[model samples]
Target: MTVSRARLALGALILVAATAVLTYAATVNVYVQRLETRLDAFGEVADHPVFRRLLDVIGYVRRFYVEEVPLDQLLEGAVDGVLQSLDDPYTVYYDAEAYESFEISLTGEYEGIGVVVTTVDEYVVVQTPFPGSPGATTYPDNHDGVSPPGLRAGDRILEVDGVSVVGMPVERAASLIRGPRGTTVRLTVERPVEGAPPQVLYFTIRRQSIEIPTVQQADMVTPRIGYLWLTQFTPDTPGQVREALKRLRDQGARAIILDLRNNPGGDLSASVQVASQFVPAGPVVHVERRGGERETYSARGGGLGLPLVVLVNGGTASASEIVAGAIQDYGSGTLLGEQTFGKGSVQTVYTWEDRQGRAAVKVTTARYLTPKERSIHAVGLTPDVEVPGTPEQQGDPQRDPQLRRAIELLEQRLGG
Candidate 1:
């Protein structure tokens, strides 16, 4: 009886080993088949020298490497290698954190320092600060608390939370600066000086929901004229504009100044919604895709029919350009200030991988044009009046002259 039991135990052990080996073999086969399919998709590149070199490197690492390699990391590295070969700054892979940020940015809702930033000459510069933003109420506090405390435009950020941003990529640096609402971030900034070390500035900012104050309203001259600054056409933009209009009307504003300066843009639908408020039923702007395909966007509603003037500048890009271009094309309002920031291409972001977090890619899908089919990409929308400044000439008052010009134009049209 003991001998029979031992034989059965040995047989069971052998069966278990066999099953394990078969399962591993099946998994390997499946991976191999998928790899083969991917290679087939690159059929035409079989003879390419660069392609062959990549394959050789991958094989060498897999076979002769001394340390164990994680398959997912290896695959990600390979994918990055492929994208790098494209040589396009706009075409690159987004890791998990970047993907999350990209998603939030598209929705136009995120918790951060509440500052829009852009890379300018190897340094990140503040584009605009949303109203009620931590930085807005914090750093620009004068002795009276009624005006700005000397922080001006074109300020270059040197550090965040005392960490140097020198060697970091602009995108990475931006991500670091942004965090959940209520978080505080101190910054060291160089005030666009000819040669000076960054000034040590501290800001204990409380992060809030950051609903993106797309529009701001003020009685420009009180009871006579008012100003409405539309930073972007976000999801909540229409309601904000409506609210501002109501406030402006309450203040007895006779003429209106609509500021679209430095607006980078937002949802296309939002642009249409905002534009609809100004013009009668008319086509505002047109969208042109690759291969000569086109579509037109028009206004369908009525709005405040006061003497109106729209302000624009060279930093007005994308959906901002759409609104400016539309107003200019339809003759709904006079465009003052400098020509717009030309970013006519529309992009679509999609998640490319599923891992611990999501990563995405934003691809330019189409080009936006005016109702007259005027290109607004490299060809910026020229304002009726131009404001010239090159940082050195105009200094910190880059858009002030332009704003003055718009206000003047609106006041004149209203016979004020």
Candidate 2:
């Protein structure tokens, strides 16, 4: 082709591309303008300074930015910024992944290897492996073909699928480990051995639908005292507690020790049910909404009528606090431990969807109070018998001063 003809063709191509870009930009601007007008019809939202400024900034970025910006990302950032500005830690916006996990948590089930972890010394450490879970079967020596060795308690999670999680929070690490059932997640773990260097190990675990048990350990601590360690309040917690109580009663238990240590609370309804098991028929907790609205949760009759003592610590929060507070206020049980975590605000999870699939907004809807009308918001509940928890006495019940004290108290009550 002639040089002049070639130059003309290239100029035509450039013009067509520029025209297409301009047309697309105009279309987007028109769409946004229409949306703004429609939203303005609702109220003062469109005229609000913050809303106007956000739109202006977004428009500017779309027009003059060095690179193309995704509208979805900008919208998500705006949502996040608004939530952050509220300054309420409990009020949060959950993206698609987080929302899905939240729903799974409510159901008391999820697809994971079934290992409960905690952040300790800047490392994600396995606190416990659920029995029959892949983690429970995973051991250094056991080499089964079907369910290979899984995670062990005290194992330091170093990496997940080649990504370093050395200083990652346990929650984040747990989310990464959880996936659709039958999928595999590779983990690099470091296990400390007694009087030897730490051992590095690798494992590929297939995730499965794990049913989280709310009642962790239930047994007779003594001849007449039963110990029920409530892990967290879940949908099945009430049934589990009821069954445990029946078994304990059948075994000739006259007293009970309800352990709520390190338990981050869950379902509110479950908490009420558990508290009702020990307290007489009356108001267990009161939920007070904004503008002074209040709702009372009354306990149903049929309490075990057994002398009870509750164990709590700084980690006892939310729904757990509801149970502990009710028990304390009603004088149904003796509380023994440090002050509670003091999360007295009630959150209602609102789920919705947009172009970004599913999302959730967990907003603080009300402030709950004990039957005695005590709002333990920032100030936690002070135990009747104050006992401190120490890191050294974590696993060893013999060294657990708090447990020993509880047993002692129960023994005295039983005159044993």
Candidate 3:
């Protein structure tokens, strides 16, 4: 019962294991084939009308066109064709150049006139300009007393170096104005005045190293009130604010005026970090989607012990809204200024392998909400005290009447 019996048992065990492994491999192959088949079927069914038209064009190229199109060329054409079909201005295909600009934007550095410009209802309008940049200086002489004709925060950029921006894509317009530092870019902008035609005002600005100041500090008329201006929620914005708060505290500031006027916003995590400095250990902002997925950002630890006043305006967007909304909802601060910009959607950038290999896709993945679960997507966040700036007034601290009101409110809180 020794050697032959043992060899037979071992052979039987090996045979069983090999059979199981083969079965598993077969099962996996079948599952993968089925999945691929289903995906192909779904893709055909979900082919948008535009995509179908693109497919028609591709068919024409494959059949009637002269030369054989390279596979890479065909893929790029297909990608561009897909985005063009949408007809939505926001939905766009970024070539290497535009994608590079986007990358620079994320790092908060770009070689431009330091202006964020976009088309709003067929007119090129100036979005928020980075502090100390050319755009901030380009304004009317009446506003803030910053001399020499410069573009204001809300001015319309009609032409770039005499090139008419009308009927041009925003990306093209942006590209035309943005270039290397020390280079001069002339902008023919339209000042928003009553009964004034789109004037040809030239701004020959030499671009410089535009380091965006996340936090600005000033002493109000009430000596006890220290005003802190938070432009955007950048990566180091929380630390900047903490340092500002410390300086304000050291200056014997009893009431704090947090100004968030015309801030188009930045990093979401930075907003949560800034908000965490104000609120107690509780939910600061809750991010949710249409499908019931949820994520809650909570305050870290201690709280700023002072009469807090948050100032917001039309440009206050995304993460700025998050901070402002949280402060207002928790009774931690009083909000002043105009309604916010209301860009509350969260996006995720992903690259996936398809039939054409890997392609980058950025899709709106989630919607943001206040601590009380109030969605501020299209509907902007309204302030407690509404103060709108006139066309004559457009800059910082001084140009914003709303910020002044915030200072006044903080002073009042300090019994000044």
Best by lDDT: 2
| Comparing 1 and 3 on TM-score, the stronger one | 3
- TM-score-sorted candidate list, best first: 3, 2, 1
Please give, for residues 253-325, the per-residue lDDT of candidate 2 as tens digits. Answer: 9999898876667778888888899888999899888899998999996665888889887667778889999
| lDDT, candidate 2, at 82 | 62
- Candidate 1's C-alpha runs over 4 A off are 1-49, 60-92, 106-109, 118-126, 135-171, 180-209, 218-220, 246-251, 301-305, 352-357, 387-405
Model 1, span 1-416: residue lDDT tens: 25744443333222111111000001122234334544454444545666556555655676689987764566556655554444433344567876666556555577776666654545766655554556555653123444343223356778888788863445667787888776677677665444776444445566666766576545545357778888677667877887787788788888777877656677787887788887767787777667989878888887558877787765576777777787787777888766665667765543433335555444455677787788877668988767654222111223356556666677677673
Model 1: lDDT of residue 272: 76
Query: What tens-digit string does per-residue lDDT give for candidate 3 at 1-416?
Result: 35743443333222111110000001122234434544554444334565445445655675677888754466555555444444433333444565555555555577776766645555577767665677665554233443443554457788888889875656667778878888888877766665866444557777766666677554543568777777777678888888888887888888888777667777788888989888777888887866798989899867778898887766677788888898888889888777776767775543333453333333355778899989897677888887765323433446657666776677667773
**Local distance difference test, per candidate?**
0.61, 0.71, 0.64
Model 3 — TM-score against the truth?
Answer: 0.74
TM-score on alpha carbons, each prediction: 0.69, 0.69, 0.74
